[model samples]
Target: MPAARQHLFLLCLLLPISLSYEIQLILVNNCNYSVWPGVLGSAGHATPEDGGFHLGLGEEAVFDVPSWWSGRVWGRQGCGFDGQGKGSCDSGDCGGMLQCKGAGGAPPATVVEMTFGTDRSPLHFYDVSLVDGFNLPVTMAPVGGGVGCGVAGCEVDLNVCCPSKLEVKRNGKVVGCKSACLALKADKYCCTGDYGSPKICKPTLFSHLFKSICPRAYSFAFDDSSSLNICRASRYLITFCPPAR
Candidate 1:
Protein backbone atom coordinates (compact mmCIF):
# COMPACT_ATOMS: atom_id res chain seq x y z
CA MET A 1 0.00 0.00 0.00
CA PRO A 2 1.09 3.61 -0.54
CA ALA A 3 2.45 5.54 2.50
CA ALA A 4 -0.62 7.90 2.54
CA ARG A 5 -3.07 4.98 2.48
CA GLN A 6 -1.25 3.24 5.35
CA HIS A 7 -1.34 6.41 7.48
CA LEU A 8 -5.11 6.85 6.87
CA PHE A 9 -5.80 3.28 7.98
CA LEU A 10 -3.84 3.76 11.21
CA LEU A 11 -5.77 6.95 12.05
CA CYS A 12 -9.11 5.17 11.53
CA LEU A 13 -8.09 2.36 13.85
CA LEU A 14 -7.47 4.80 16.71
CA LEU A 15 -10.60 6.88 16.20
CA PRO A 16 -12.98 4.73 18.25
CA ILE A 17 -10.48 4.29 21.08
CA SER A 18 -9.86 8.01 21.37
CA LEU A 19 -13.55 8.85 21.49
CA SER A 20 -14.28 6.70 24.54
CA TYR A 21 -14.62 8.38 27.95
CA GLU A 22 -15.05 7.02 31.48
CA ILE A 23 -17.14 8.65 34.16
CA GLN A 24 -15.87 9.07 37.71
CA LEU A 25 -18.15 8.55 40.69
CA ILE A 26 -16.92 9.76 44.09
CA LEU A 27 -18.80 8.23 47.02
CA VAL A 28 -18.40 10.09 50.29
CA ASN A 29 -19.51 9.10 53.75
CA ASN A 30 -20.18 12.03 56.07
CA CYS A 31 -22.05 10.14 58.72
CA ASN A 32 -20.84 10.00 62.30
CA TYR A 33 -20.61 6.21 62.14
CA SER A 34 -19.35 3.74 59.56
CA VAL A 35 -21.29 2.88 56.41
CA TRP A 36 -21.11 0.18 53.76
CA PRO A 37 -21.81 1.51 50.30
CA GLY A 38 -23.49 -0.92 47.92
CA VAL A 39 -23.45 -0.76 44.13
CA LEU A 40 -25.70 -2.64 41.69
CA GLY A 41 -25.29 -2.30 37.95
CA SER A 42 -27.99 -2.62 35.34
CA ALA A 43 -28.20 -5.57 32.98
CA GLY A 44 -25.41 -5.70 30.37
CA HIS A 45 -23.56 -2.98 32.26
CA ALA A 46 -20.44 -3.63 34.33
CA THR A 47 -20.36 -2.60 37.99
CA PRO A 48 -17.02 -1.09 38.87
CA GLU A 49 -17.57 -1.24 42.62
CA ASP A 50 -20.33 -3.84 42.64
CA GLY A 51 -19.33 -5.37 45.98
CA GLY A 52 -20.10 -3.50 49.16
CA PHE A 53 -17.22 -1.75 50.92
CA HIS A 54 -16.70 -0.01 54.22
CA LEU A 55 -16.36 3.75 54.61
CA GLY A 56 -15.77 5.32 57.96
CA LEU A 57 -16.86 8.78 58.92
CA GLY A 58 -15.55 11.39 56.49
CA GLU A 59 -14.10 8.70 54.22
CA GLU A 60 -14.73 8.40 50.50
CA ALA A 61 -14.39 5.96 47.61
CA VAL A 62 -13.93 6.73 43.95
CA PHE A 63 -14.92 4.54 41.03
CA ASP A 64 -14.41 4.87 37.28
CA VAL A 65 -17.18 3.41 35.15
CA PRO A 66 -17.79 3.24 31.44
CA SER A 67 -19.64 6.08 29.80
CA TRP A 68 -22.66 3.84 29.21
CA TRP A 69 -22.88 2.67 32.81
CA SER A 70 -26.22 2.45 34.62
CA GLY A 71 -26.64 1.47 38.25
CA ARG A 72 -27.97 2.12 41.75
CA VAL A 73 -26.04 2.87 44.99
CA TRP A 74 -27.03 2.76 48.64
CA GLY A 75 -25.52 2.80 52.12
CA ARG A 76 -25.68 -0.02 54.67
CA GLN A 77 -25.54 0.63 58.39
CA GLY A 78 -24.50 -1.46 61.44
CA CYS A 79 -22.72 -4.01 59.30
CA GLY A 80 -20.65 -6.82 60.85
CA PHE A 81 -18.44 -8.57 58.36
CA ASP A 82 -16.05 -11.50 58.76
CA GLY A 83 -12.65 -11.77 57.12
CA GLN A 84 -14.24 -13.63 54.21
CA GLY A 85 -16.52 -10.66 53.26
CA LYS A 86 -19.49 -12.35 54.92
CA GLY A 87 -21.58 -10.13 57.15
CA SER A 88 -24.91 -8.44 57.80
CA CYS A 89 -26.19 -4.93 58.22
CA ASP A 90 -28.98 -3.48 60.26
CA SER A 91 -30.31 -1.70 57.21
CA GLY A 92 -29.60 -2.22 53.54
CA ASP A 93 -28.18 -5.69 54.12
CA CYS A 94 -27.17 -7.65 51.00
CA GLY A 95 -27.56 -11.31 51.93
CA GLY A 96 -24.99 -11.06 54.78
CA MET A 97 -22.18 -10.44 52.34
CA LEU A 98 -19.64 -7.67 52.70
CA GLN A 99 -19.49 -7.44 48.96
CA CYS A 100 -22.97 -7.21 47.57
CA LYS A 101 -21.81 -8.53 44.20
CA GLY A 102 -25.00 -8.41 42.08
CA ALA A 103 -27.41 -8.44 44.99
CA GLY A 104 -29.39 -5.32 45.88
CA GLY A 105 -29.55 -3.76 49.29
CA ALA A 106 -32.60 -4.38 51.43
CA PRO A 107 -35.02 -1.60 52.26
CA PRO A 108 -35.50 0.87 53.81
CA ALA A 109 -32.34 2.33 52.30
CA THR A 110 -31.86 5.59 50.46
CA VAL A 111 -30.88 4.81 46.86
CA VAL A 112 -29.01 6.85 44.29
CA GLU A 113 -29.73 5.82 40.71
CA MET A 114 -27.75 6.97 37.70
CA THR A 115 -27.47 6.30 33.97
CA PHE A 116 -24.51 7.69 32.07
CA GLY A 117 -24.54 8.74 28.46
CA THR A 118 -23.57 7.01 25.23
CA ASP A 119 -21.34 8.35 22.51
CA ARG A 120 -24.29 9.15 20.30
CA SER A 121 -26.26 11.11 22.90
CA PRO A 122 -24.21 12.34 25.84
CA LEU A 123 -26.79 13.08 28.47
CA HIS A 124 -26.54 11.71 32.03
CA PHE A 125 -29.60 11.08 34.19
CA TYR A 126 -29.57 10.72 37.96
CA ASP A 127 -31.93 10.78 40.93
CA VAL A 128 -32.23 9.95 44.62
CA SER A 129 -35.17 7.60 45.06
CA LEU A 130 -37.16 7.16 48.25
CA VAL A 131 -39.61 4.82 46.62
CA ASP A 132 -37.97 1.92 48.44
CA GLY A 133 -37.46 3.98 51.60
CA PHE A 134 -34.81 6.12 53.32
CA ASN A 135 -32.12 5.04 55.76
CA LEU A 136 -29.74 7.95 55.46
CA PRO A 137 -29.51 11.37 53.89
CA VAL A 138 -27.92 11.28 50.41
CA THR A 139 -27.08 13.83 47.73
CA MET A 140 -26.02 13.34 44.09
CA ALA A 141 -24.53 16.24 42.20
CA PRO A 142 -22.14 16.87 39.38
CA VAL A 143 -18.61 17.57 40.52
CA GLY A 144 -18.43 20.63 38.33
CA GLY A 145 -21.11 22.98 37.09
CA GLY A 146 -23.08 21.93 34.01
CA VAL A 147 -25.69 23.96 32.22
CA GLY A 148 -29.26 23.12 33.25
CA CYS A 149 -28.05 20.47 35.65
CA GLY A 150 -29.68 20.36 39.08
CA VAL A 151 -28.84 18.32 42.16
CA ALA A 152 -31.15 15.55 43.38
CA GLY A 153 -31.26 14.16 46.92
CA CYS A 154 -32.58 14.33 50.46
CA GLU A 155 -30.42 16.52 52.66
CA VAL A 156 -32.36 16.16 55.87
CA ASP A 157 -32.48 12.96 57.90
CA LEU A 158 -35.99 11.53 57.60
CA ASN A 159 -35.67 9.12 60.54
CA VAL A 160 -35.97 11.98 62.99
CA CYS A 161 -39.64 12.48 62.18
CA CYS A 162 -40.52 9.17 60.64
CA PRO A 163 -44.12 8.25 61.32
CA SER A 164 -44.51 5.61 63.98
CA LYS A 165 -45.89 3.07 61.55
CA LEU A 166 -43.14 3.61 59.00
CA GLU A 167 -40.05 3.74 61.20
CA VAL A 168 -37.41 1.01 61.13
CA LYS A 169 -35.80 0.73 64.54
CA ARG A 170 -32.55 -0.92 65.55
CA ASN A 171 -31.40 -1.03 69.13
CA GLY A 172 -34.38 1.19 70.05
CA LYS A 173 -33.29 3.88 67.62
CA VAL A 174 -34.92 4.80 64.33
CA VAL A 175 -32.45 3.88 61.62
CA GLY A 176 -34.70 4.14 58.59
CA CYS A 177 -38.03 5.49 57.52
CA LYS A 178 -40.11 3.24 55.30
CA SER A 179 -42.12 4.72 52.47
CA ALA A 180 -45.86 4.41 52.88
CA CYS A 181 -45.95 2.05 49.93
CA LEU A 182 -43.55 -0.30 51.66
CA ALA A 183 -45.41 0.01 54.91
CA LEU A 184 -48.90 -0.36 53.46
CA LYS A 185 -48.22 -2.59 50.43
CA ALA A 186 -51.42 -1.30 48.83
CA ASP A 187 -52.01 -0.62 45.15
CA LYS A 188 -52.63 3.04 45.88
CA TYR A 189 -49.39 3.45 47.78
CA CYS A 190 -47.23 1.17 45.63
CA CYS A 191 -48.68 2.66 42.42
CA THR A 192 -49.30 -0.76 40.97
CA GLY A 193 -52.07 -2.32 38.86
CA ASP A 194 -54.70 0.34 38.12
CA TYR A 195 -52.67 3.00 39.89
CA GLY A 196 -49.59 2.47 37.75
CA SER A 197 -50.12 5.56 35.61
CA PRO A 198 -48.89 8.92 36.75
CA LYS A 199 -52.35 10.44 36.56
CA ILE A 200 -53.86 7.69 38.69
CA CYS A 201 -50.97 7.46 41.12
CA LYS A 202 -51.08 10.86 42.70
CA PRO A 203 -48.90 11.58 45.67
CA THR A 204 -50.22 10.36 48.99
CA LEU A 205 -50.01 12.12 52.34
CA PHE A 206 -46.85 10.26 53.21
CA SER A 207 -45.29 11.11 49.88
CA HIS A 208 -46.32 14.70 50.35
CA LEU A 209 -44.53 14.76 53.67
CA PHE A 210 -41.44 13.35 52.05
CA LYS A 211 -41.54 15.89 49.23
CA SER A 212 -42.09 18.68 51.65
CA ILE A 213 -39.02 17.60 53.56
CA CYS A 214 -36.82 16.92 50.53
CA PRO A 215 -38.20 18.64 47.48
CA ARG A 216 -35.31 17.52 45.28
CA ALA A 217 -35.66 13.78 46.00
CA TYR A 218 -38.12 11.29 44.54
CA SER A 219 -40.69 10.48 47.17
CA PHE A 220 -42.53 7.81 45.23
CA ALA A 221 -42.52 5.79 42.02
CA PHE A 222 -44.42 8.36 39.94
CA ASP A 223 -42.27 11.19 41.20
CA ASP A 224 -40.42 12.32 38.13
CA SER A 225 -39.86 15.49 36.09
CA SER A 226 -38.88 17.50 39.13
CA SER A 227 -36.87 14.78 40.83
CA LEU A 228 -34.91 13.62 37.79
CA ASN A 229 -31.81 15.62 36.84
CA ILE A 230 -30.08 15.51 33.48
CA CYS A 231 -26.53 16.62 32.92
CA ARG A 232 -23.33 16.05 30.98
CA ALA A 233 -20.40 15.91 33.31
CA SER A 234 -17.31 13.72 33.57
CA ARG A 235 -17.65 13.27 37.30
CA TYR A 236 -20.35 13.12 40.01
CA LEU A 237 -20.39 12.97 43.80
CA ILE A 238 -22.74 10.84 45.91
CA THR A 239 -22.56 11.78 49.58
CA PHE A 240 -24.12 9.94 52.50
CA CYS A 241 -25.22 12.10 55.42
CA PRO A 242 -24.54 15.14 53.32
CA PRO A 243 -23.79 18.27 55.28
CA ALA A 244 -26.52 20.79 55.96
CA ARG A 245 -26.69 23.71 53.59
Candidate 2:
Protein backbone atom coordinates (compact mmCIF):
# COMPACT_ATOMS: atom_id res chain seq x y z
CA MET A 1 0.00 0.00 0.00
CA PRO A 2 2.70 2.50 -0.89
CA ALA A 3 1.54 6.08 -1.53
CA ALA A 4 2.54 6.02 -5.22
CA ARG A 5 1.05 2.57 -5.73
CA GLN A 6 -2.30 3.59 -4.30
CA HIS A 7 -2.93 6.66 -6.45
CA LEU A 8 -1.46 5.59 -9.80
CA PHE A 9 -3.12 2.16 -9.73
CA LEU A 10 -3.44 2.10 -13.55
CA LEU A 11 -2.51 4.03 -16.73
CA CYS A 12 -1.21 4.15 -20.36
CA LEU A 13 -0.15 7.78 -20.77
CA LEU A 14 1.94 6.92 -23.79
CA LEU A 15 5.50 8.36 -23.97
CA PRO A 16 5.91 11.36 -26.24
CA ILE A 17 4.19 13.87 -23.99
CA SER A 18 7.47 15.65 -24.63
CA LEU A 19 9.23 13.83 -27.46
CA SER A 20 9.52 10.13 -28.36
CA TYR A 21 12.85 8.42 -27.67
CA GLU A 22 14.04 11.86 -26.60
CA ILE A 23 13.20 10.96 -23.04
CA GLN A 24 12.27 7.32 -22.60
CA LEU A 25 13.59 6.40 -19.14
CA ILE A 26 12.86 8.37 -15.99
CA LEU A 27 13.61 7.83 -12.28
CA VAL A 28 11.59 8.96 -9.31
CA ASN A 29 12.75 8.88 -5.67
CA ASN A 30 9.28 9.25 -4.17
CA CYS A 31 10.04 6.07 -2.28
CA ASN A 32 12.18 5.70 0.85
CA TYR A 33 15.06 5.36 -1.63
CA SER A 34 15.37 5.95 -5.40
CA VAL A 35 16.28 3.90 -8.50
CA TRP A 36 17.41 4.66 -12.05
CA PRO A 37 17.57 2.73 -15.33
CA GLY A 38 21.16 3.96 -15.76
CA VAL A 39 22.32 4.01 -19.41
CA LEU A 40 20.72 1.23 -21.43
CA GLY A 41 21.68 2.63 -24.87
CA SER A 42 19.37 3.00 -27.89
CA ALA A 43 18.32 -0.62 -27.65
CA GLY A 44 15.96 0.42 -24.83
CA HIS A 45 17.77 -2.26 -22.82
CA ALA A 46 19.90 -1.62 -19.75
CA THR A 47 22.89 -3.71 -18.63
CA PRO A 48 24.46 -4.32 -15.16
CA GLU A 49 26.82 -1.35 -14.73
CA ASP A 50 24.02 0.34 -16.61
CA GLY A 51 21.29 -1.05 -14.39
CA GLY A 52 20.89 -0.98 -10.61
CA PHE A 53 20.77 2.82 -10.82
CA HIS A 54 19.78 4.44 -7.52
CA LEU A 55 18.29 7.71 -6.33
CA GLY A 56 17.27 9.34 -3.04
CA LEU A 57 13.83 10.45 -1.90
CA GLY A 58 12.41 13.41 -3.89
CA GLU A 59 15.04 12.68 -6.54
CA GLU A 60 14.31 12.23 -10.27
CA ALA A 61 16.16 10.77 -13.28
CA VAL A 62 15.31 10.92 -16.99
CA PHE A 63 16.59 8.73 -19.83
CA ASP A 64 15.80 8.74 -23.54
CA VAL A 65 13.94 5.66 -24.79
CA PRO A 66 16.14 3.67 -27.14
CA SER A 67 15.53 4.69 -30.76
CA TRP A 68 15.85 1.17 -32.14
CA TRP A 69 13.01 -0.47 -30.28
CA SER A 70 9.30 0.05 -30.64
CA GLY A 71 6.54 -1.26 -28.41
CA ARG A 72 5.74 -1.02 -24.70
CA VAL A 73 8.37 0.06 -22.17
CA TRP A 74 8.56 0.58 -18.42
CA GLY A 75 10.75 1.77 -15.51
CA ARG A 76 10.29 -0.99 -12.99
CA GLN A 77 12.07 -1.59 -9.67
CA GLY A 78 14.23 -4.69 -9.63
CA CYS A 79 14.12 -6.92 -6.56
CA GLY A 80 17.82 -6.36 -6.22
CA PHE A 81 20.45 -6.40 -3.51
CA ASP A 82 19.61 -5.03 -0.07
CA GLY A 83 15.95 -5.29 -1.06
CA GLN A 84 14.12 -3.31 -3.78
CA GLY A 85 14.14 0.40 -2.98
CA LYS A 86 16.95 0.63 -0.44
CA GLY A 87 19.20 -1.58 -2.59
CA SER A 88 18.05 -4.42 -0.37
CA CYS A 89 17.21 -7.56 -2.41
CA ASP A 90 14.63 -10.17 -3.26
CA SER A 91 15.06 -13.89 -2.49
CA GLY A 92 13.09 -14.77 -5.63
CA ASP A 93 12.11 -13.23 -9.01
CA CYS A 94 14.62 -10.64 -10.16
CA GLY A 95 16.51 -11.37 -6.94
CA GLY A 96 18.12 -8.20 -8.21
CA MET A 97 17.54 -9.19 -11.82
CA LEU A 98 16.38 -6.45 -14.18
CA GLN A 99 13.03 -6.94 -15.95
CA CYS A 100 12.14 -9.61 -13.41
CA LYS A 101 8.67 -9.16 -11.98
CA GLY A 102 8.55 -5.99 -14.09
CA ALA A 103 9.88 -3.67 -11.44
CA GLY A 104 7.50 -5.22 -9.03
CA GLY A 105 10.41 -4.23 -6.78
CA ALA A 106 8.44 -1.16 -5.67
CA PRO A 107 4.82 -0.15 -5.39
CA PRO A 108 2.88 1.62 -8.17
CA ALA A 109 3.87 5.12 -9.25
CA THR A 110 2.86 8.37 -7.56
CA VAL A 111 4.63 10.76 -9.94
CA VAL A 112 3.22 9.21 -13.10
CA GLU A 113 3.48 10.10 -16.77
CA MET A 114 3.15 13.84 -17.27
CA THR A 115 2.43 13.29 -21.01
CA PHE A 116 1.74 10.77 -23.80
CA GLY A 117 3.42 9.38 -26.93
CA THR A 118 2.98 11.10 -30.27
CA ASP A 119 4.09 8.41 -32.76
CA ARG A 120 1.55 6.15 -31.06
CA SER A 121 -1.01 6.24 -28.31
CA PRO A 122 0.73 6.71 -24.94
CA LEU A 123 -0.70 3.93 -22.86
CA HIS A 124 0.66 1.55 -20.16
CA PHE A 125 -2.60 -0.27 -19.54
CA TYR A 126 -3.81 -3.41 -17.79
CA ASP A 127 -3.40 -5.43 -20.97
CA VAL A 128 -5.54 -7.83 -18.93
CA SER A 129 -8.79 -5.80 -19.11
CA LEU A 130 -9.30 -5.64 -22.89
CA VAL A 131 -9.52 -8.32 -25.52
CA ASP A 132 -11.87 -7.49 -28.41
CA GLY A 133 -15.37 -6.60 -27.10
CA PHE A 134 -15.09 -9.42 -24.55
CA ASN A 135 -14.07 -8.46 -21.01
CA LEU A 136 -13.47 -11.10 -18.33
CA PRO A 137 -15.36 -9.08 -15.74
CA VAL A 138 -18.78 -8.90 -17.49
CA THR A 139 -18.75 -12.47 -18.83
CA MET A 140 -16.35 -15.17 -17.62
CA ALA A 141 -16.08 -18.03 -20.13
CA PRO A 142 -15.52 -17.54 -23.87
CA VAL A 143 -19.13 -18.57 -24.42
CA GLY A 144 -20.74 -15.42 -25.84
CA GLY A 145 -24.11 -14.69 -24.18
CA GLY A 146 -26.46 -11.99 -25.58
CA VAL A 147 -27.85 -13.73 -28.69
CA GLY A 148 -30.50 -15.92 -27.05
CA CYS A 149 -32.94 -15.19 -24.28
CA GLY A 150 -34.91 -17.34 -21.74
CA VAL A 151 -32.98 -20.21 -23.24
CA ALA A 152 -30.65 -22.75 -21.65
CA GLY A 153 -27.25 -22.30 -23.33
CA CYS A 154 -25.79 -21.34 -26.65
CA GLU A 155 -22.41 -20.92 -28.33
CA VAL A 156 -22.58 -17.12 -28.76
CA ASP A 157 -23.64 -16.04 -25.30
CA LEU A 158 -23.25 -12.32 -25.97
CA ASN A 159 -25.50 -11.01 -28.74
CA VAL A 160 -25.03 -7.88 -30.90
CA CYS A 161 -26.99 -5.83 -33.46
CA CYS A 162 -26.58 -2.52 -35.28
CA PRO A 163 -29.14 0.03 -36.49
CA SER A 164 -29.42 1.11 -40.09
CA LYS A 165 -27.40 4.15 -39.02
CA LEU A 166 -25.78 5.51 -35.87
CA GLU A 167 -26.07 9.17 -34.94
CA VAL A 168 -22.72 10.04 -33.38
CA LYS A 169 -21.48 13.13 -31.57
CA ARG A 170 -18.40 14.24 -29.66
CA ASN A 171 -18.22 16.61 -26.68
CA GLY A 172 -21.82 17.65 -27.28
CA LYS A 173 -20.90 18.91 -30.74
CA VAL A 174 -22.90 16.28 -32.61
CA VAL A 175 -20.15 14.54 -34.55
CA GLY A 176 -22.67 12.32 -36.38
CA CYS A 177 -23.82 8.75 -35.81
CA LYS A 178 -23.64 5.19 -37.00
CA SER A 179 -26.26 2.55 -36.31
CA ALA A 180 -24.55 -0.03 -34.13
CA CYS A 181 -24.23 -1.31 -30.58
CA LEU A 182 -25.73 1.68 -28.84
CA ALA A 183 -25.94 -0.33 -25.67
CA LEU A 184 -23.01 -2.21 -24.19
CA LYS A 185 -24.35 -5.28 -22.35
CA ALA A 186 -25.37 -7.18 -25.47
CA ASP A 187 -28.38 -6.06 -27.41
CA LYS A 188 -31.27 -8.37 -28.17
CA TYR A 189 -32.87 -7.15 -31.35
CA CYS A 190 -36.49 -7.66 -32.39
CA CYS A 191 -37.03 -11.14 -33.74
CA THR A 192 -40.53 -10.03 -34.81
CA GLY A 193 -40.12 -10.82 -38.48
CA ASP A 194 -42.58 -9.37 -41.01
CA TYR A 195 -43.65 -12.10 -43.45
CA GLY A 196 -40.40 -13.92 -42.69
CA SER A 197 -38.50 -10.70 -43.41
CA PRO A 198 -36.48 -11.49 -40.25
CA LYS A 199 -37.78 -8.83 -37.92
CA ILE A 200 -35.28 -7.37 -35.44
CA CYS A 201 -34.73 -4.08 -33.65
CA LYS A 202 -34.90 -1.63 -36.52
CA PRO A 203 -33.09 1.67 -37.08
CA THR A 204 -35.83 3.61 -35.31
CA LEU A 205 -35.72 1.30 -32.29
CA PHE A 206 -31.92 1.53 -31.98
CA SER A 207 -31.87 5.19 -32.93
CA HIS A 208 -34.32 5.87 -30.13
CA LEU A 209 -32.29 3.67 -27.79
CA PHE A 210 -29.03 5.45 -28.57
CA LYS A 211 -30.72 8.80 -28.20
CA SER A 212 -32.06 7.63 -24.86
CA ILE A 213 -28.98 5.70 -23.81
CA CYS A 214 -25.44 6.72 -24.82
CA PRO A 215 -25.26 10.54 -25.17
CA ARG A 216 -26.54 11.22 -21.68
CA ALA A 217 -23.74 9.45 -19.74
CA TYR A 218 -21.09 8.77 -22.39
CA SER A 219 -19.17 10.55 -25.12
CA PHE A 220 -16.80 9.66 -27.92
CA ALA A 221 -13.75 10.25 -25.73
CA PHE A 222 -14.96 7.69 -23.24
CA ASP A 223 -14.12 4.82 -25.54
CA ASP A 224 -11.51 4.02 -22.89
CA SER A 225 -14.19 3.44 -20.26
CA SER A 226 -16.04 0.14 -20.29
CA SER A 227 -19.40 0.48 -22.06
CA LEU A 228 -20.82 -2.40 -19.98
CA ASN A 229 -20.19 -0.32 -16.85
CA ILE A 230 -22.57 2.50 -17.78
CA CYS A 231 -25.84 0.61 -18.10
CA ARG A 232 -26.77 -1.98 -15.50
CA ALA A 233 -29.33 -4.38 -16.98
CA SER A 234 -31.21 -4.34 -20.25
CA ARG A 235 -32.97 -6.72 -22.64
CA TYR A 236 -31.51 -4.87 -25.62
CA LEU A 237 -27.98 -3.36 -25.94
CA ILE A 238 -26.21 -1.63 -28.81
CA THR A 239 -22.56 -1.53 -29.82
CA PHE A 240 -20.30 0.12 -32.36
CA CYS A 241 -18.37 -3.13 -32.57
CA PRO A 242 -18.65 -6.77 -31.56
CA PRO A 243 -16.43 -9.84 -31.17
CA ALA A 244 -15.59 -11.87 -34.25
CA ARG A 245 -17.69 -14.95 -35.00
lDDT (0 to 1) per candidate: 0.91, 0.27
RMSD of each: 1.4, 22.7
Judged by TM-score, which candidate is best?
1
lDDT of 1: 0.91
Q: Which residues of candidate 1, in runs, are more than 4 Å off?
A: 1-7
Model 2 agreement with the true structure over 1-245: per-residue lDDT tens digits: 88787555533243334344332333344433334332222234433233444445466555444333222222333234444334332111223454332332221111111121233543221111111111001111112323221111111211122232432222443222232333332343322233223234333344344323322221121222322221111121111112323
Runs in model 2 deviating more than 4 A are 1-21, 34-51, 67-93, 98-245
Lowest-scoring 10 consecutive residues by lDDT in candidate 1? 43-52
Give the C-alpha miss distance for residue 32 in model 2, angstroms.
3.0
lDDT of 1 by residue, 26-85 (tens): 999999999999999989876666568999989999989989899999999999988998
